[model samples]
Target: MNTPAALTLEAPAEHPFAPFVRILGKGKRGARNLTREEAREAMGMLLEDKVEDTQLGAFLMLLRHKEESAEEMAGFTEAVRERLTAPAIQVDIDWPTYAGKKRHLPWYLLAAKCLAQNGVRIFMHGGGAHTAGRLYSEQLLDALAIPLCRNWQSVNEALDTGNLAFMPLQDWAPHLQSMIDLRNTLGLRSPIHSLARILNPLGARCGLQSIFHPGYQSVHREASSLLGDNSIVIKGDGGEVEINPDTLSHLYGTTAGVGWDEEWPALSARRHVKPASLQPEHLLALWRAEVEDSYPQLALLSTMALALRGLGTPREQAFEQAQRFWDNRDTSI
Candidate 1:
């Protein structure tokens, strides 16, 4: 919390979003052409806490109903960039981050760790506590003994050592993390969630964005198209950046002139069927067994491995990398 800074949000002069907001508040359901600049003004309002809760709720509902545009996503992302603090170390090591999606236990952790252990730096971010319901990314990371770091400096240290880096959302970006509480108060997901995913500053050398849903997949791709270079967008498990189904994962990256298809041929392999078990211990033991056979823990591991390799090998090879790491497991990171 930045001490509730003085309200500074104001729509730009001659902005055309007024009509969109009015039409949306009235329950009209057509496309509202809010230019990228106009949306920036809205983000300004949100950042400044100038937007009223009533209008905020309506804005979220309308955006959800009308869906988001690539331009809007880009604009909001720009606003988020203005809000985010830079990562500590600037390295060419690009790691995929899985934020804002459902995660399975040991499965997701195993996958992230697979690439992480091999020097590809893994970064995962999320909010909302497990006190609400079942498993969360935080809990899974905890079970694996991954330390939840407190600052950007700690993240660099973790990455430098070829270990997974986990951080609670609030420590790095309180301006944005503070909004997670709003989801509880408003019972709606605001644009902050979307912007947070794409605007992360990790892997400063090569920024990567993971697309989970059919809708946001395109959103991430289009956003990258505008970013010029050093950005990646890929569709994977439940919005994770990791491949889940062992099917072809469409990766879009022309940064440094390296195409996404560069990794396509390498992804071919059998889909690792998601193992089922109620007991946590039972599920983890099963995961370890899969590791013994050199199989991937789940979709996340395979996806993270391949994304890190970017055509290093087929999905099986990537799975093997994950398996090797797990087998030689350093329970301490």
Candidate 2:
């Protein structure tokens, strides 16, 4: 066998996000995390398309390999926030739905609709079907009769009448959406996935968000705390914001710039089981009282309780208030 020799590689001097890639990939001792400021600049360059496609791919994978720091995520989120062109609108909640549902119909859509009918203005944004075998929120919005806003003007109009609107990530933040689309090639999620959730583009006073991984709870909590937004992060069902009524959910977040956590006990003693089939229309039917599924009803109420808490309702009263809203929701919408 021939003896192996060490080889040195160099990042292009002129490439944007190159320095960021080096900071993450420069071998054990040489690699270091980016300062929040550096991360902001790097992400700004990314949003501006200052980095080449190859450089962008390498940067994302390198960041994924090392995992993202809360500071880095906070910085990247700041960059995305600064780039948003959404017109000023009164939004009560910033709901980011990135993780598409697979095993369950998106019961959380009913939760949001309930909240909207109760006069809460919700600004929701997300991508659709980035991964195969997943059912995304956008796929069901039409059936729910919720407007999928294509631009800031449309968003304003929808929120004006419906008190809720869903903006596709591609329409709201094309750069980050492009990165999300790379999931098929990367074979793993990049930091952009986490960053987009915290964008809170409208700078809403409260945020309702979730992550697939439990460890990411701290990343989201710390980042939101740093951003000084009253937000709640949970390990949601199928990684969507829908609460899992079958297991305890440890919620982590910051309230008025102070870090706090709350544990929500499971809603049912029966073992949580996914439905054999995920029918999007079932959501509408349930809303219309045409279908009477116990689990979906529990999921809608549980999810709304969390949203109510995030909106500053006292924890003990939130569920009751959510149920009240659910009972009185406008079926005509």
lDDT string, candidate 1, 188-225, tens digits:
66656666666656634555566665756666667655
Query: For this target, which candidate reaches the highest lDDT against the unseen true structure?
Result: 2
Task: Name the TM-score of candidate 2.
Answer: 0.94
Cα TM-score per model: 0.73, 0.94
| Model 2 stretches astray by more than 4 angstroms | 1-16
Q: Native-vs-model 2 lDDT?
A: 0.87
Q: Cα lDDT of all candidates, in order?
A: 0.59, 0.87
lDDT of 2 by residue, 57-175 (tens): 99899888888888888888888887777778889989899888888888999999999988899999997788888898888888888889989898889889989999998998888
Residue 274 C-alpha lDDT in model 1? 50
lDDT (C-alpha) at residue 89 in model 2: 88
Worst 10 residues of 2 by lDDT: 11-20
